[model samples]
Structure formats: structure tokens, C-alpha cells
Target: MKYDSLARDIIRHVGGKENVIDVVHCVTRLRFRLKDEGKADTERLKAMDGVVTVIQSGGQYQVVIGNQVAEVYDAVLEAGGFGNAVSQEEKPEQKGGLMSRLIDIVSGLFTPVLGVLAATGMIKGLTGMLAALGILSTASGTYQLLYIIGDSMFYFLPMYLGFTAAKKFKLNEFVGMTIGACLVYPSLTAIMAGEPLFKVMEGTILQSPVHLKFLGLPVLLMRYSSSVIPVIIAVYFAARLQNRIKKILPDVVKGFLTPCITLLIIVPATFLVIGPVATWMSQIVGAVTMAIYGLSPMAAGFLLGGTWQLLVMFGLHWGMAPVGLNNLVTYGYDAVTVLKSATPIVTACVVLAVALRTKDKKMKGICWPACISSLFGVSEPSIYGVTLPLKRPFIITLLCSALGGVIMGAFQTKAFMAGGMGIFSIPSYINPETGIDGSLYGYLLAIVISGGLGFILTWFFGLSPEKKEDSASSSASDIVINSPLRGRVIPLDQVEDEAFSCGVMGMGAAVIPSEGRVHAPVDGVVTALFPTLHAIGITSDEGVEILIHIGMDTVKLNGDGFKAHAAQGDRVRKGQLLVEFDMEKIKQAGYSLTTPVIISNTPAYQAVTVLAQTGDGAGTENGAKISCEDGLLCISTC
Candidate 1:
């Protein structure tokens, strides 16, 4: 758990498990729907190691963890035990308009399976590439088998949509999958294509087919596989109907009858009405999309491409995802999302430009990975780690990408499949019947133009004034630390915190404080103080970064029982009052004040040891009193 401490820190700074309403993640960010954004320590989150940045957008508190967000998300769940939050209701006061809610819902539904979706999509693209290169014949068994593997996800997409929709709607996930399975059931599509079981009223439906009938009503049959909107709508109604059935049914029979009545009614209604209406609605959506794309493709391209990152920043990209997916299903190709190709390509180019221009050694190293990652269609690194922070570079990248989009639109570029983005998505742009068409050439041109423009724009004016490199060094010899509070000294290994006890956070010792007041143990400058006021960090004149934590997990108190007397960066003498706390308040709040005072930078020292002391330290004695002026620990420098 390299990120365990980071996860723990994230959880602590995001107002704890009690404050998190729900949490989910995408490629690079852990999007937490928090109970109170006001409780979050944004500066702490940004300054913490392993966290790239923090964003409060579209009613989500997003912690940018770069590519390792999934692992961190899992660790966060494990740390906070927020698994149940996945199916919980969104708070009414979470804020944002309908756009935010939609993004939240769409992201929740698609996020779980997007990894597999990308994998299969990439395989499909690879297969296409193989076929195009004549490495595998389209007629070969191997090609056919791999095609089956690649196409299965799209072929049975309804089931996947149903499962995700059910989870989002707070209904049984398996039940949703069952509904999805029924939608893609093999015989259903065959019957719809072959012939109707009986004929419906003439001209009622264009195809003139009714595959199945219930009682006397004609059950309209349509191909439901690969469809998104219908199954999602069906599951929505299923959840509502399931709830209603459960309410009316008796407890003993509720489990059996609720699903029985719900599915029996819902599935046919889906087939007879919901599916057909939703399918027609999809046609209307396709028509509207075609209209939009047709309304001066270059202008459409420029607007969408230029503003997409802004949408992404505000988390509004989710609103467009369904539109693009719908276009893919309805038209057998997508233009809306296909135009987004320039964004990542441009990001890679801009990062390369910055890498070349910047004198920042760390930044030069960061740009390499960010550039490569963006080329493969993951833009978080380039966006968060490089461009966005610089402000100007990000805007320039967007404009350059938008110019590429305009060219793409002018050529009428479109994609037939989804895949890993950027250059990897090229196979997706190839027209199936024609090998490579205008779409491929035009999109390639877009990438070239976008990259070229981004590089040129960024290299010229993207960077800020160079910073002086940090080159400070230090050396030291034997030095001792005194007790920070009136308490009984305890061995570091005996402390309750595993990080301190196991020497992960650093070499540390504990004190079961007898007095609530915390004092400076050495003549030092305060370096940091926790937002909760329960912890203080100091850098001694000898260059030791010492941490004085008031209590175990006292951060959860939200500063209720703690008060800071010494501000961060203030120089203080030994035994000077640094913090005052309510011991009874902490006790009443059910927190033990067995504080740990440790040298956080203990690794810098050759050895750090607690000094053996006589009795009467900080009023824990039988007869005498000793303040923080007393010695606690000793260190020998490397």
C-alpha cells in the first residue's frame, strides 16, 4: 500500500468517512461527493505527496492522483469503508444544476466497465490493424475468433448498460443484468428479423412485425442489443416498479413476488412500449445530431473542440458521452466524439514544447510521461501535471486542438468504433468497407495540425519566469529533543499508530499527556499546522522537522477541542505555549490524547533516540513537576 498513507491522508483531509457522501473515480481523479465541501482541506490535499491537485467541480470534490487513481480509490474505500456509498442516494444539497447531476449519473454508470470497454475496443482496433496490414485475413478463423472477442462487448452492450443503470438507480445489480441478458437474448433478435409471430394493425409500425403478444396486446419487437437509451430507461422504470411492488406485497412473499411481478411487467413493457419508444427517441437524437454536425461542420468542430476541455474542467463532458454513444448505435459511426481526437494529440505536443522550453528539471522529467500518456489518449497527466497549472499553455492547447477539430469537421471525419485514444484510435477511424477513407486521412491531418500548432504556440509563450533551483544542504551532530507536553514518555514501538510504531512515517515516540497544553520542545520555527489544529510541525534551528500530534486520529475532531497558540512559521523558544486543548472535551468527544511527538525527518539523522529520563516530567510525577523545558530525545546527524 504505497498509497495507503496518501489514501488515509486524503480521507482525513476530505472531512473523514463521516463527511463523505459517496466516492467514485475515472482515469486520473477520485471524485468524492462530500457532505460538506467546507470541511475539506484543499491546501493540505494539494501539498500532500502523491496528490497531483484538487478540484471542486460539478458538485464533485475531485482529488487528482494521476494514473494511480484506481488503486487509491480502492484504498480509500478500504480505509473509509464507503462501498455502500456506491448505491446511496445523492444528497439534495450537493449543489450544481441538472448538468452536474447528469455527469454524476453517467460517470457512475460507465466508470465501472470503461476499463474493459477500452481493452476490448483496443483489441478491436488491433484486429482492424492486423487485417489492414494483411497479417490476418478477414476470412481466417483466428480473425473471426478475435473479432468475436472484440465485438462481444458492443453486441451485448444493453446488458452492461442495464447492470450499471440498476446500480446507479439503487436497484439490484444482478436483477439489472438479468434484464440486460433478456434484452440481448439470441432468439429475440432472430425472431424480430425473421418474422412476427402474428401481424399487427397495418402501418402501425414501419417494419410490420409483432414477434410476441401478451394476452391481446401486440408486443412490439425491435433489436435491443447494442442499444443504450432503452435499457437505461427500462431499468429506471424497473427500479420504480420494483419499489412499488415491494411496498404492496407482504413481507414473506415480497422477495419472490416483487421480482416476479416487476420483471414480468417490466420486460414486456420494455419490449412492447419502452424499447420501441426509446428506440424512436434514439432516431430523433440521431437526426438532431446529424443536424448539428451538418450545421457547418468546421464551426461545430471549432466550438466543441475549443470548449470540450472547459466542459471537462466543469465535468460536463459526461453530458456529451451519451450523445456520442447514441450516435454510434444509431448511425453505425460517430462524428461527435471522433472530433475529440485533436485534444489529446495537442496535449502531447504542448507538453513536448514545454519540456523543451522549461529549465525546471523536475518539470522536464514530468513532461515525458505526460506526453506519452496523452499520445495514448489519457489526457489527465498532460492536463493536470503540465498544461492546466500553467494557465496559458492549457488555453493555447485547447485553441490549437480546436483548430484541428475545425479541419476534421471540414473533411467530415467520423469513427466507427471506440478504442484507446490518440494515435491508437486510428484503426477506429478506418472505414470498414473501404479500408481507409477520407475519415482516416482527414483525422490524421487533424492530429498533425493540432500537434504542430500546439507545439508552436506553447514553445513561444507558455512558460512563466524560471525559478531558482533549490540547492540547500545540511549536516549536523548529536542533538537532544525535549518533551513537548507534560506527559509520561513511552517507547516509539509501543505507540498505537502503526505508521509511527512500525517506523513508516518516521522514528517516533509517544506521550500519554497529563496536561492539555503543548509547548515547544526546542528553539525552532513552526513549519506546519494541521487545519484541525490537532497537530503542529516545527523545524528546529538544527534542521529537524518535528511533528507534535495532539492525539490519535484527532483530525476527526475538526478542531473542536484544540487551539493553536503558535502560528505556522513563528519562531518560538523551548517551553513556550504552542497549543492549548480541552482534555475533558477530547474525552467527551471519545478521543484519547496519547499524543505522538516524532522527528518526521528522522531518516535524515544517523540515529534518533528517546532520552532516558528520571521521574517528574510534565506533571506526571509523584512529587515534582517538569515542563517541556525537559529533554525527551537525542539525534546524531548523518
Candidate 2:
């Protein structure tokens, strides 16, 4: 919740606010556009509080903050500035780069739509399931009411596009919406319906043709409901037109004239050229997709199912949405059938693996909700919190997905509707004329085979080291405490904050007195000292890695006032110093000194514990000790 301070520290740590170009947010990450990627302090940011992880992907420096990303994004904006203007200018010019620009434009257009699209998709999926299970009947009032819940959004999709386009193009949103509304107006829809209003003979109207024109140019009437491209183009042009007009027009006249002129030009042009062109292009895309589906259903299935996860990883899956929607609109079904079957199977596999591999009660508790959410077609929890962290499970799940996709493709399975990937998507697979007996069997079989095989494989091989280690009876005498700091002992859990409340970060007695100094807690070798110097890892003679982390967000200082006493691979003794810092200077620089003494090699430990309070003084017999039982100085205490 208090990520403002952390964000400020991160910006300053990564070469200061001037180095940042722009900051934006996705569902769970703060994506930054930096002037120079090389100057980023990745390790330092990772060590900060409230940061779940950090990733550099798709030319973006992504700081993952989980559910609280909006808060972090606000904090980042306050610390840095708005817009990616700096980064944009710093970007190198490319030759004949239309393709790259197109890709960027398309990605930007769809980014904000992804969340709503996914939600609507899930809702549609659920409606199908309810109808299928007899809980709701197609002819019933209840079913009709619920159907509207999911269908209205898609039916008025042009409006959604207009809003998103306005945001993307930095235009007036209401104006965009008005333009979209005009295209979908009841009268326009009625005119576009059935057949041509009239056949022109020598450019003369017969039976009063419903032709719309601007300045003598005939406008081509095309349906805009559920359409994607035309409204976006209209809004983009409208924004530019409005801006240009506003610059020269008097303020009193500008307000009314801008909208009047924008709509007049945009609406006619949209119908005359933009609408027709976009429709033709969409048709081509749809045809191409159908052709691919017809060529090899299994191949298409395998590719879609196997690569869907990868697309999701890069946030590029929204590019395929038009295809799915086009299929639904054109043929009332989708031939790319593997996703619904493969996604659930892959999710089930990961959930099963995590359930069996982890022994940590807290972790297990978290995984359960993630697994349940996945069953409903939400994979974020599983992807970020479970599978990705475990490594092997994620790969295995993907492999299984590919296998399942191939089977579905071989069957030439098709979904007769557009919906989310889950059990609820079964209705989309339904052949209504033949009832539930059509493609339903094949889909069910695919799910069982892929999920069952994946689950069994992971159960046997996915066990984590932390689960197998003994924790209830390990002894501190067998373990060695490698000093993370060289300063004098200050006692246990001293500094401040909830991070040190239950020793969640680590376990050990706290230290103070010296000027932010770090020393070897035991005779061991330094295995890793992060580039940011926020934390260090030392492997003791007993083969346990002791991690010493300085104050929270201290990494944001970017090694400014701290100096490392040793380098990687250095051998040191219990009292050998590792790093020295100006504690007073660091505190004044705005960093919390609630240090954590963690066991980086948690797998090697049976248990670790914190003993005594801050004033209890170190080196005393009353201080903490690692043991098997739950006591103030025992292992079970953790």
C-alpha cells in the first residue's frame, strides 16, 4: 500500500528520475520505458518491499507488484513524470519501419481492451454452461436475462472500441463515443439491413435512396456494430482534427465547432471509405484464418494451444481476438478449437503439480485459490505465483498443452461460439442440432488425457526441496549463522515494521553500533553479492547459504554510500568484514534499517529461528538458536 516511498527509491536507484522515460501499468505490473535500459537497478528493485518480481521483456522494464499495481503506478508517476516522451525521443530511427510501427500501434490499441475482453469472454462461457446443464433454458426468461448480461457488451462492441481508441489516440472520449453511436444508430442499422435501398441510374435516386453524402461525395454505408477498425480510425482522425481546429479557432466558437466539424468529416469519411476498407480487410483476415483452420485442424490446434501461453507471456494474445470474433460473426463458430481444451488441461496440470510439490502450509493455502481461479479460465495466479517459480511444472504443462492441441487438431474439432477456455466453453463446442452428443465427447476426452497425464508426471517429479527437508527437529549447532553485517549485535527483530514481525524475511538476532558494516557471520565463501549491494549470499562450511539484507529499499541508493568489502568467490571467516556503509548517512537518505537475516539456501535448513528482543544484546546465551522444537530459541519457533 505504501509503495510511493519504494517507487521513489527505485527511480533514484536506477540513475534517478531523469533516467526514466515513462511509466504505465498492466493488471499486475508497472511497466517502465527507460531512456537507457543499461542503467536499471533490477536486483535492487527486486529486493524492495511490495515488489513481487521484476522482468525485462518486450523492450519494457516490468516491475511486478501483483494486485496493488495501480497504487505502485500512481506512486511511480508521482516520483517520475507522465508520458514516455523521454524514451520515445531516445529511440533510434529505423529504416522502412512500417511493420514495426504497425505492430506497436496494434499492441497499444488492444492493451486496455484485454481485461474487459477476457472478462466478457468468461461471462459468455458461463452462460453457455448454464444453458447446457439445464439450469437455464434457452427459451426461458431467466436465460434471456442472463444472456443479455454477456451479449450486450459484444453487440455494442463499437462503443467500447471508440472509448479505447480515444484513450490510445489521446482524444476526447465522449466525441469518439458519439461517432460510434452514430454508426450504430437504429436508422443507419435499418438502412444497411436487407438489401440496397435503390439502384442508381445516371446518378439519380430511385424510390428515394437512403444515401448519406458529404459535400457531394457519396458515402458507402457499412455496419459499424461489433466492428473494430473503423471506429478506431474515426476517433484517431477526429482527435487530430479537433486539435488542429482548436489551435486557430476562437475559444467561444471552438467548443461547438470542433465537435461539429469533427463528426461531419469523420462520419461521412468513415462510411464512404474507412468503413468499407476496414470491412474488406477484416473479411480477408477472417478468410485467411478459416483457410488455415481448414488446411490442418490438428496443426492449427497444436499451434494455438501450444503457443497461446507464449503469446500471453508477451501480452500479444489480444491480436488473435479479431479472428475469434470474426469466426463467431461470420459462421457462428470457431474452427480453432484447441484452446478451450488445452488451456484447462494445462492449468489443471500446474495446479496438481503445485499441490503435490509444496509442503509449505502458507504456500499451499495460496495455491488452492489460484487453482480454483484457473478452473474458471483465470491463469494469472497460477502463472505468476506457482508454475513460473517452480520452473519444471510450467514447461511440462506447456508440453502437455501441445500434445492435447495436436489431438484436437487431428479430430478437426470446432467451437460453434466464442468464449473463454474452460469447462463452460463446452457449449461453444456443442452441435445444437444433434444436442450434446456431437463434438462434446472429443473435448472431454482431450481434457482427461492431457490433464491426467500432466498431473501424474508432475506428481512424480515436481517435488520441491523445501518440502522434503526436515523442519521440526533441526539443530542450530549443526547450522552456522553467517554474519550479514559487520556491525555489533543489536539483538533480535529490532528496527521496525511488519516485515520483521514474525521473521518472515529471515530469522536471527539483530545488530547495531557500527556504521552499516557487513561481516561474515561464519567461516564461509561469498557465493553472490547482488550488483545493487542490497543483499549478499554466503555459503557456510555446513553448506547453508546465509542471506543478509540491509534496510528495506536500501537498494534504491544504488550503492551510493555503501562499499562492498569482498567480491564473489572470496573466502572469509566468521568475523571477516564483507561490506561497510554510512548508517547515519543511509538513514538520512531515507531508508529503513529493518534488516533481514534469511537463509538463501532454505532447502538446506531444517529450521531457523529468531531469539531475544532488540535490547537483549547478542553473544549472550539467551539469544536465538536453531532447534527442532517450537521455543523462543528453537527451530519450530519459526
Candidate 3:
């Protein structure tokens, strides 16, 4: 419950628990699929504390929560009444085009294991570096143990993919895992390596040695270890197959019978058809990618590296992960993806430059942490929080990273294994057989020049004096909170309750209501409406949050004298009647009709000025009558 408040706020702002169709988390974000994206308050979420930023892309509402995203994700599940298992029935109707859905599906499948994947990759890379450096002998038992720990995930990647893919496709997870286990079964792998009975598809890319016979059909076995696409396709097929089997079988026998029938059909079908096709497709993709990279390595590097962060911003970065893994499996080492190894370092350098030059304390604070995180290969914070908000610096990062990519590509740098990110990934360049090679040196040199130049260029050219770009961009207009009640305007401090009077809730003017109607203060959605109808919260379309409390300690009356005209999540225009109360009835009930209208999220704004009072005088003093049409408060974002 450490993040309980943040969790509740997130759920509320994301159109409540009912709006969420499904939710998943990655390294640093909580990705939600909502039934209606329109109900979400994007600006309100962006202004929230503990959230790094909010992104809507690839058919997802992604809330970036820095490194604590996992804990926050757990809290969100608990708070939103969600079970750990994802249900296919819960998924919203698909929106967006093919690309968007692909990105969503791919990210979801990979996100669950990304953290541990990176960790294991790092461990393997480090051990490889140690072995190459002669710090540990490859024959050493300690080395063997460490390698096994690090390598097991990659070796049995098909099974992991099966488990995750089954969840994504809504199949029984264990059934998919069983299919994967069958693909990588030790005996099957050994058979694939043995002498073939005959060769089939003799003269084409599809040509393969027939390894074994499956009920008289020639089985074309594929090396499933460390592979990507085959298991995913197989699992999808198994999921569909299982669903079909369940429909035919009766409930009494279906529990065990469904899987038994599914496996019998899918396992052989996979080895005979799905495996060969997917493996060929993966090989074709790898071949095409390598050929493209081989044509002009630097150009490929420049394009991919420059746009890498942009892809990360939209969560499309996962698309390239499969390709990289395919290359690692098809070819022993990957030369293409290794070109982007310097991108994080480049981002780190750029943010460091921003931290050094920015006059704003907040930007400086954000930059320092972002810079540190980027150095460790988590650049989402730097990209979304620090640089992307300041357009010039973000552009500088891309250009620098592109140049770094060009340099690395020119040297033909390659990654022998799926390594760690940022600095820890350096060891992935070390040749397993040779000590330090030109590739590793070339990578080191590329990062140095690229990162150093990034700092220089960003410091000198990325910012302007006063760092006014952000302020200028946000200067479209000030948000005006109109008076929500016909009453005598009074200073908040003069109110009876200390919570509102002392500005403990937020800063805003109060009113002594002459009438009982409460109107919408701005064009916005009603975010919160208390059951007692004595209080309401509205976040304006432009992101100012306003709270109107009917009276001090009014909860005792419950819904006695209060009536709601608008419910929570209702979209209302300025001056629209939201709530009505009987003033005489409240007065007779002995409750003070002192209403405090406040900006609930005051800290996100630069200033909250009480506009001039009306009727009696134009100054912001007490005892001035104000109408619902009058401008009561002006909020400035920058």
C-alpha cells in the first residue's frame, strides 16, 4: 500500500476501474487498455506526483513511473480489484491499425520478462568478458555454473515465450508451455542434429533435411533453442486449437481431455508445418535485415539509432527486439543492433548538459536523475521527462546517437550475445575466444566521441537564455475557473474550517452561498462527486483541477439537503448546473453555508491568482457578491 494513494489517483484519473479493459506493466510503465480513451484525463495524469509522464500510443495509455513501476503496478492491481491472471473476455474491442496492435501485442509478450531478461543477459555478458580477460577459465566449475544461470533463459526461450504468448492469446498457459517443452525436448534436439534420411524442397530457401517421420509424414525439425518466432506462432495455434477442442468436449471430461486432444493435434502439426514455416520466415527476415545493413552499414545505423528513442517514446521499440534475437539465433553474432549500443550513453550526455545549463531548479533536478538512469540503460526517463519536453535537447540526442551508430557500424561492431544495456553491455562486444578486439575498442571509441559531442552540442545550442521554450510553448492562455456559486466572495483564510482556511487542501477563494446551486467552474469532466453530494472535483480540459466543498463538516447531513445534477465522470461546460442544495434547509439544520472552492492540484501550476471580485467592488476582498458567470480564479501553468 506504499503507493496506494498514487494507485487510487491513477485509477480514478484513467476513467476509473470500469474503464480499464486490461492493464500490464513493463520496465518503467503501467500500460492500460481502456474501453474509452476519451474518459481518461491525460493532462491530469501528467500533472500527477510520482508519475514521470503519460503517453498515448500503440492503442495504450502508458503511465511512466520510473524504476518503481513494478511496485506501483502491483499496487494498481490491488487497488483496481484486478486478479493477476488476464482474461480474454476482459479485453476491449481492438482499435487502431495493424501496426498499432502489433506493437501492443509484441510489447505485452516481451514486457513480463524484460527485466529478468536484461539481468541474465548482463550476467552472461559479464562472464564472457571475464573469460576473455582470463579472469575465469571457461573450464572452471564456477564459470560453468554462472554461464548456466545466465544462459538457461535464452536456451529455453521457447518455453518462456509459450507461457507468455498463451496468456496473450488467452490459451491455457500450461498447455502452451507443454507444447514448447515438446519442441525443445532433449531427444528431439538430438534427432535434429543427427543424419537426415533425405533432403526435401531440394533447391530453394525452404530446402531442409528430413530428420524423422511423424506417422509417415516427413518431420522437418528446427533448432528451437534461443529461437523467437516459432514458439509464438505455435502457441497461437495451440490456443486456437485448445479453444476449439474445449467447445467440442463436454465439461465433465474437458478439464483434462481438452489439453490431451490439443497436444495430440498441435505437437505434430507444429513440427511438420508451423516450425519449418516460422523458422524459414525468421531466417528470411534476418537475411533481409542483414542484407540491408550490409548495403550501407552507416546509413542503416544512422536511421535506426536516430529514431530509436522516438520508437521508445511510442513503445514501438519492442518490434526490433524480435529481429535482433532472430539475428542472434540465425547468425552467431548480430552486427546490426549492436550499432545502437551507444544511444543510451548519448542520451545520458545530453541530459547531463541540460542539467549543467538549465537555470530552473526543477529541470536540473529532473535532468540529474534522468542522466544517471540513462547511463544504466533506462533512457525512458531522460527521453520522456527531461529531453522530449525540451525539444531541442531531444533532437540533439538523436543526432548524436546517430553519429555514434555510424561510427560503430563503420567498424563492423557485433554483439555475440544478448547483453546488458548501457555500460554493462560493453562486455557483449568482447570476443568470446579472443580478449579485447577491434570491435570492443571501436564501440568504446564511438560512445566516447558521440557522448562527448552530445554534451558539447546540447550545452551550447540546445537551450536558450532563461530556458523559456517550455514557458513559451505553454503560453497559449491561462485557465480561468469561473465562479461555481452565486455568493459573497470571501478570503479562504476567513473560513471556519482550518483544512480549507489554511490552504491545506489547495489555494483558492471561498464563498458564503446566498443560493444553493453549484455550477461547473470550467469545461471539464467531473472527476469526483462525493456520495453525500456536498463536494465535487472537476479537472478542466486544459488541466486545472478545481474542488468545490458545499460547507464545513457537511458529511453529517449525508444527502439530506443536497441533490446532484451531474455525476462523477460527467462532462460539463462552464456555468452548467452541477449540484443544487436547499440553502434554507441547510441553515435550518444549523450548518454553516461556507463553501470553499479550491484548486486541488495547486503544486503543478506556477501561480493561482484570485481574480478581481465583482458587484460591490473590483478588488479581491471579502463581502463582494459574485455570480456563476464571473471569473473567480486564474491558473497559470508556467
Task: Please tell me which predicted candidate would have the highest lDDT against the true structure.
Answer: 3
Each candidate structure's TM-score, on Cα atoms with residue i matched to residue i, is 0.47, 0.45, 0.47
Model 3: ten consecutive residues of lowest lDDT: 86-95
Deviation of model 1 at 181, angstroms = 2.0
- Between candidates 1 and 2, the lDDT winner: 1
Q: Which stretches of candidate 1 lie over 4 Å from their true place?
A: 1-115, 157-170, 191-251, 265-281, 289-295, 300-405, 411-441, 451-587, 593-638
List pairs with backbone clashes in candidate 1. Answer: 482-632, 486-618
How far residue 180's Cα lies from its native spot in candidate 2, in Å, is 15
**Ten contiguous residues minimizing lDDT sum, candidate 1:** 87-96
Each model's C-alpha lDDT?
0.71, 0.60, 0.75
Give the C-alpha miss distance for residue 486 in model 2, angstroms.
Answer: 7.3
Q: Per-residue lDDT of 1-638 in model 2, one digit per residue for the tens?
A: 37778878878766687776677654345667788988988888888887766777656777766545556676776667653222111111221256445334443454455455445545555676677677887899977876677656656766766876776676667788888788778797666555664443334211123355557665556555555556767788888988898898898897688888888888777777764454444444334444666787766666667766655543234446667777678876665634436675567567766775654444475566656556656555465455644546667777778777777766666687665457656666788666675366667777778887778767776542331223454543444353454334444455453334334434555544345667676665665565556667666554655667677656556667777777554556667777777788788987766565665445345666544433324343334332212112223312
Worst 10-residue lDDT window for candidate 2 reads 86-95
lDDT string for model 3 (342-407, tens) is 998998999999898765555576677667657767665566556765667878999999999889
- Model 3 lDDT on a 0 to 1 scale: 0.75
